[model samples]
Target: MEDRYSAVVDLQGDSKQAAEFSAKNLNKNIMLEVENKDENELVDVVREGYLTTNSGFLKEDVNGGTCCVTALIRKGNLIVSNAGDCRAVMSRNGVAEALTTEEHMDGKANA
Candidate 1:
C-alpha cells in the first residue's frame, strides 16, 4: 500500500502582525515524532493570507480575521488526524469519499 500524509495551516487577517505571527507560530509548532510506523511524511503547509487595513484608522483591524490549520496522517491507505475549512477526499473504484469537513466561525459554513 502507498503511505502518504499532508498538512496545511492557513492564516488570514486584516493585520499584518496577526497574520505573520500566526503563520510563524504555526510553522514552529509543526514537527514529526517517532511512531514505529514506516512511511514518508511531509512537513506542514503554512499559508498566510493578505493583510487588511482601514484607511480611516491608522491601526490594524481585527474584524473578519480568520485562521485555519489542518493535519493529515496516513499509514497503509489509512488516514488519521485533526482538520479544520479543509477538505480531504479519496477515489477508489470510481467513487469519491470525503474524509474531513471544514471548520468555520459561523457554524453554518466550513473552514
Candidate 2:
C-alpha cells in the first residue's frame, strides 16, 4: 500500500513539474503558441509520467497497484485519470458528484 501510494505521489509531483516547466519554457518562446499545444503537451506529460512510474515498479519487481490521479492546474484545467478500482469524487453544494465512474472487474463502468 505504501509503495503504491508513493508511486502515485511521485507521478503527481512529476506531472506538476512537467506542466510548470512546459509553461515556463513555452512562455519564453513566442513561436510555440499553436492551438491546443499546451494542453496536448500536458496530457502527454501525464501519460509519460504514468508509464515511467509503472515501468519503474516492474523493473524493481514490485507488485501491481491501482491509482487515481487528479490534477488541478492554475489555468482552470481539471484532469482526472485512474486505473483499476479507483475513482474521483467532487462535492457540489450539499451533494456528492462523481468525477470519475467506477469500474467493475468485467471491464465495464459501474455507474
- lDDT (C-alpha, whole model) for all candidates: 0.37, 0.47
Clashing pairs in 1: 14-52, 85-102, 85-103, 85-111, 102-111, 103-111
List the candidate 2 regions with Cα displacement exceeding 4 Å. Answer: 1-37, 103-111
Per-residue alpha-carbon lDDT of candidate 1 for residues 3-109, written as tens digits (9 for 90 to 100) = 99987444343545544554554434332231333444332121111111111122434432333444435454333322233466668898997755554434222
Candidate 2, pairs of clashing residues: none
Please write out the lDDT profile of model 2 over residues 14-46, one tens digit for every residue. 444444443444223322232335754655545
Q: Which ten residues in a row have the lowest lDDT in candidate 2?
A: 26-35
Model 1 scores what on Cα lDDT? 0.37
For each of the candidates, give the backbone clash count: 6, 0
